[model samples]
Structures are given as C-alpha cells and as structure tokens.
Target: MKTEPDAFSLEDLRQRGREPWEGIRNYQARNFLRGMRIGDGVFIYHSRVAAPGIVGTAEVVTTAYPDPTQFDPQSKYYDAASSLARPRWDLVDVAYRHTLAKPFPLERLRALPEFADSPLVRKGNRLSIVPITANQWDRVLQPAR
Candidate 1:
C-alpha cells in the first residue's frame, strides 16, 4: 500500500512568493500542513495545466501557521469569520529546489510497475497534497540517481 506524492504547479509556487500560502480550502490539504514537520520533503508538482508531473523538490521551511486567507473576507480562500483568535486552517513553508533535468512525467510513473499502482499517478484522483512513502520517494528520484 502506497500513498502518492502531492503535486504543485509552477504558477502556484510563484504565487508563494506573493502570498506565502493561500487558496487551500480543503481540510485534508490543511491537515497535511498541520502534520508537516520542518525539513520534510516535497515533490513539487504541476497541476491544473498541461504536462503535469514532478518538476522539482521543495523543503518544508516552517511549521504550521494560521492561514491568513481564512481571515480575509475579500480573499478567495477567506473563511469569512476565521480569525487569529480562532483560525480554521493552517499551512507550512516550503522552498524550491533545482528543477529536475527530466521531469518524472505522469507517463513514466504509470509505465513503471512500482509506480503504476501509486495513488498519485492513477487517474481520477487529485489530492493537492499526498504523502510520499520512503520507498516511493526513492523511485521517483531514482532516475535522477
């Protein structure tokens, strides 16, 4: 049994520079935040666009914090009533690593017997953030190895 890697698009990462962390309205994604520990590995993914796959790696920079978007009524992710006193969601800080020479494209993952059964590469499953097992982590990175 393997949990898949969560993917982040290039645009989303660029947004990080502007807003830090925002637009995560889902609780599961939020939970990933709450559970995240500093130095945790991240598989930077490209989603909601053409050519999605693991493009780079990221490192957790900070522990969970109240998501400011939940407090801003004007913001899209705003929870309307959440506040510093009682926050609803949280997020972690992640920094980008150098891009992969050959992105572990979705096709490649599906072709491999090991990754074929992976939850991340499977169709009809889209989780903004997924947990990567120690072994699964090695597989994606093996190509670069």
Candidate 2:
C-alpha cells in the first residue's frame, strides 16, 4: 500500500512490528482494505517522495475492521457521517515482513513489461491500495532478490 514517508515509513513499520492500516478516505481504497485477508502480502510503497517506490513487504495480520480514527472527532480522518453502529471506513492490521534488498523505483517498474498493466503505472491512478497478481508480485520482488 502506498503511504507518504512523512506519515509512515517502512522503517517505522519495522520498529512498530504491526499497525492498523488506516486513514483511507477513498471508497476504492477502502474496498481494497476490506478485501484483504489474513496472511495477504502487501508491498509497502513510499509515495510522494523524491524516489517513490516499493521499499518493503508486509503481511496482513488481521481482517478488515472499523477504522477507529473515523469515530474520533479529533482525528484528521474522522468522518462526521460515520457512526460506531456503521462505520464508513475500514482498516486491516499489517505486520512488517522484510525490507526489499533494494528499493524498486516506480520508474523502473513502469519500464518493465511485467507491470505494464499495473494500476501503479497508470497516470493519475492514485489509489493507495491496488491488487497485484501473483505473477506481478513475483516479478516485482525478483529484482530486489
């Protein structure tokens, strides 16, 4: 999932071990989070940085649940329309797996035929979470290995 380093970096995830993947306001991204099952693989991507790329991997430790931030008025992600009875946002718990041997820069990924169809390579595609096929996943980590 793509996150700005200023908000949460791969190093921060490693230190924390696990954390709730939260603050997703987009409906499409929220659906992606909801679809995640335990043990699902995630590419921890750093976006909006000088060298944006996938820097590590993480595993889904928990299935989707209500994002608590949506209920807290003080939170930036709080939704006035969201209620405890029916939350508008959902999140999953993710545990740090391992950092890639090298960051897979977006430029390189775009040039690879394996990822030519990836949403990440599409201009103006800003969904934080996107599904990757098994083949695509393997191709992405191959270079890092």
Q: Mind giving the per-residue lDDT tens digits that candidate 1 earns over 42-143?
A: 777766545667776777788889877788778778886677888888877676654577777777777877775667787887567777776767787876
Off by over 4 Å in 2: 143-145
Every candidate's lDDT: 0.68, 0.92
Candidate 1 residues lying further than 4 Å off, grouped into runs, are: 1-19, 113-117
For each candidate in turn, give its C-alpha RMSD to the true structure in angstroms: 4.7, 1.2
For candidate 1, the C-alpha RMSD (Å) to the true structure equals: 4.7
The estimated TM-scores of all candidates read 0.79, 0.96
lDDT of 2: 0.92
